[model samples]
Target: MAVILRYVDNKSQVIERFMGVQYVIETTSSKLKESIDEFLKLHDLSYSNLRGQGYDGTSNMRALVALAKKNSDIGAFFTMTNSLVNVVGCSCKRRDALRDKQQENLMKAIENDCLETGQGLNQEISLKRAGDTRWNSHYDALISLITTFSSVVDMFDMIVEDCYNDSAELDDCFAEGNTELLICLARLSPNDSFVAFDKEKLVFLAQMYPKDFTDQDRSALQDQLDIYIHFVCSDNDFSQLRGINELAKKMVDKGLHRTFAYVYLLV
Candidate 1:
């Protein structure tokens, strides 16, 4: 860390001069004081010239943190989600097992007339592992995990039957109460108004509001919006929306600012 000495020069103007940086070997308050004293000494400066000082200190001892780890539902959810993802995504073989199992389930659903068939419906979709800098990655990972849940728990069951390795990626993946956590998170979702794709969805819905579009026009608008979102979201320039609500408001203001259109109600 860099340390600077603050003092008024001979010109009577306050000036902040850059002092040399020192590598800190210890972090205790006494040790930090010693380090500062040594730093001043190296510059042939005296502590008597010091007027004010700043030091790192805790503001309060309260630990009112999000996802408090001391035995809460949120902590359990985090632990369960993390452990399950680690166990399932640990190897390509396990991931393949999950996909195969999901495919089998999908086939059964289609046979029972529970799921509709379409061109891309049977294509393979696999698990997503979460990353550090992205919260949405965790949501995606959790969705995949839930979709492949029964198959994954079966794998965990098999692992425990053979030989469970507590230190390995399977740690706590098969814990009994995790199902509740999974169900809870699966039902919880952020409001659609803030989702990036939701702006187009809302606009399409507004176009169907009986004032702007007929039935045929609504379907056409839906297809057009789908294609447009697919194109823009794929392009690097329009992808990764960071201000969806602001953009939605701007669009509404542009179209329905002074009009008696029902589209203004959509905003």
Candidate 2:
């Protein structure tokens, strides 16, 4: 692996130097520390002098996975889903059974006129196995599970009738206060001609940040919002904007951001 050092010199300019690479048998934490220590010693530098560190994309993803696994429910769900994929895809016979079951269900639905038929619709899909290092794999696995749920239940019935006999229960992840806050926040969305905008909710949101906005600022914000909403709704340029990102850019391009500073800040 290679190392680089970045520091500010006496001239108040930033400098970065590429330190040579080191060969190591493993990339484990201990092995990497030893290699870095050797490099520091060779350069007459001390590890204690370092102030900050950086990680690459792979390292960041691994850290996210580790953090997410701390939630017991999330961790248990992933574990169960992984095991379910393995059990269902253990052999060719089981896989074939799953496919046949899906096909049978599709035919029944088609006959009952319960499903729409199109050239590109009703394609067969298999279960997706998630990976440890990539978080998106878990999402793909969950979608696959949803699509193949009925067939999976049939497979489980053939194998063990009493496995997972307990009824599944769902827990509410958000409380009432959080739900209200989320709704108020959603009222600020600029999508669909700013149809979600609510002047009262915006005022409530401003009131929450007492340190940033005082009673006078909140009072002025109400009038500013009235004019701001009128200006954006009637203006052709703002009407076509898709999301908050485009709205923000257009506001700057048209110099409206400064005109409605409080409104833009809330956005």
Candidate 3:
């Protein structure tokens, strides 16, 4: 399963946005793609300006993301994780075993059904187990499916309960919205809509720190930050970079002053 979140500049209109001209937030599965794509398309948003991709570790997502980044207008930077233990651990072996056990229980139900009344609940336990197998199996399968895509299932429930209020606002925009990709681009890219972070923070510090610390602490720190932002840090680095001014202050205090370099990083 792979999920991609196409980040709109928050300031841009739906119509002015291009198909790939947006910031993208990605997760490890395609399970949410259909819904997300539907959400965006309905709003007349294009993914043209996609500058980032984020995801948890998974071969399917990694391959597809690589393809998207290379071929699309997305930024060169990508964010991915090695693994999401909680999600994967639940879905891997343990879930499969539970499913098998459920199937056996359902089979027992069917066998008991035939020994008494029909497969209906009113039947004696024996008869219920007879024909009940099929029904039980069906129910179990449904439950198992839910467990498998639990994250998405949770999201769907939220969407339903909300009555798509956010979507409604988007729908209003869509009604008056132009279909041009560039127009949509404009809606998503507003400065007010942009996100910022504090580089002084640990997360940003990790990116700004030097990979190879030397006796010369400042040079080492600058090198670390460069390596981290460029190669070491994953997708989280971009989305999570902290305080531009504060980060600048530290860098300047350290003696490596290059505004263009940082700007190049952001763009």
Candidate 4:
């Protein structure tokens, strides 16, 4: 987790500064508070004067921070957009197909005078998984989605068209799997527990704009983080991450605890 300290300095001017990041073995409310206390003690900072607390949606975390005396909010909007990106960008083959289709559409549009060539307008555009650190990431994703909607649908059609048996896919989209898939998608979004994947990334973005972090980034980070988590989950190399929690348990059972060497190398 990352910590930023905000306060009125000796001159009575308000100051907010980065206190650096720390890792915790577990994210339960109790462990997080202990980590914070340790961080404050290590840095010789006082926690008594903390005027408020800020975080993305997590009841336990809020309760943990409340010990420091605080208030909070949640984000669910960006979560939906991230979900859309995942639904479309599940594989590199699909992503490449989407880009190829996008270029074809762009060229056709230009030929028909539907789109004009300009400085940034005609440049190669790709589907960007949302990012909170990038300025106007939401805006860019919105524009891309609108422009590439047809391409996205076409690519998905092409991918599924080759499948000899698409009965399972059809079932998932239209029948018994529909409600379960919807609920699963909702749970995978930034508003749910999966936002934990991008916790530190969100913190960096949040710290970049502290005032806006409370106002906007708090909500936007969820969307970007959801996109990130989806991408990571979709990647083959990171496939093992899907079972990380269970793997940790197995490691514990095997007596292969996280040693200093193991943690150092992992970091």
lDDT value for model 3: 0.39
Candidate 3, residues 23-132, lDDT tens digits: the string is 23543256445545665686676667555554434453444445455644332211111122233234444334444444455566568874243455332111011011
**Model 4: per-residue lDDT, tens digit, 59-131?**
5234333322222221344556677788767788777878888889888998999987887766666665655
Q: Is candidate 1 or candidate 3 better by TM-score?
A: 1
What number of backbone clashes does candidate 4 have, counting pairs of residues 3 or more apart or in separate chains?
Answer: 0
lDDT of 1 by residue, 1-267 (tens): 235555788999886544544556776778778889888888898889788875433221112112134437746776777777788788887778777788888889889999889887656667676544433455667777777777777778766765646544365665533563343332211234323344444444554357767767555555555554454445454333345354345445555222323222333
Candidate 3's clash total is 77
The residue ranges of model 3 lying beyond 4 angstroms of the native Cα positions read 6-39, 47-100, 108-267
Clash count per candidate = 0, 0, 77, 0
For model 2, the superposed segments whose C-alpha errors exceed 4 Å read: 1-56, 161-267
Worst 10 contiguous positions by lDDT, candidate 2: 164-173
Candidates in order have lDDT scores of 0.57, 0.80, 0.39, 0.57
User: TM-score per candidate, in order?
Assistant: 0.33, 0.39, 0.17, 0.32
Model 4 Cα shift for residue 116 (angstroms): 0.7
Give the deviation of candidate 4 from the true structure as CA RMSD.
31.0
What does candidate 2 score on TM?
A: 0.39
Q: What are the candidates' C-alpha RMSDs?
A: 26.4, 24.2, 27.7, 31.0
lDDT of 1 at 39: 88
Residue 22 CA displacement from its true place in model 1, Å: 47
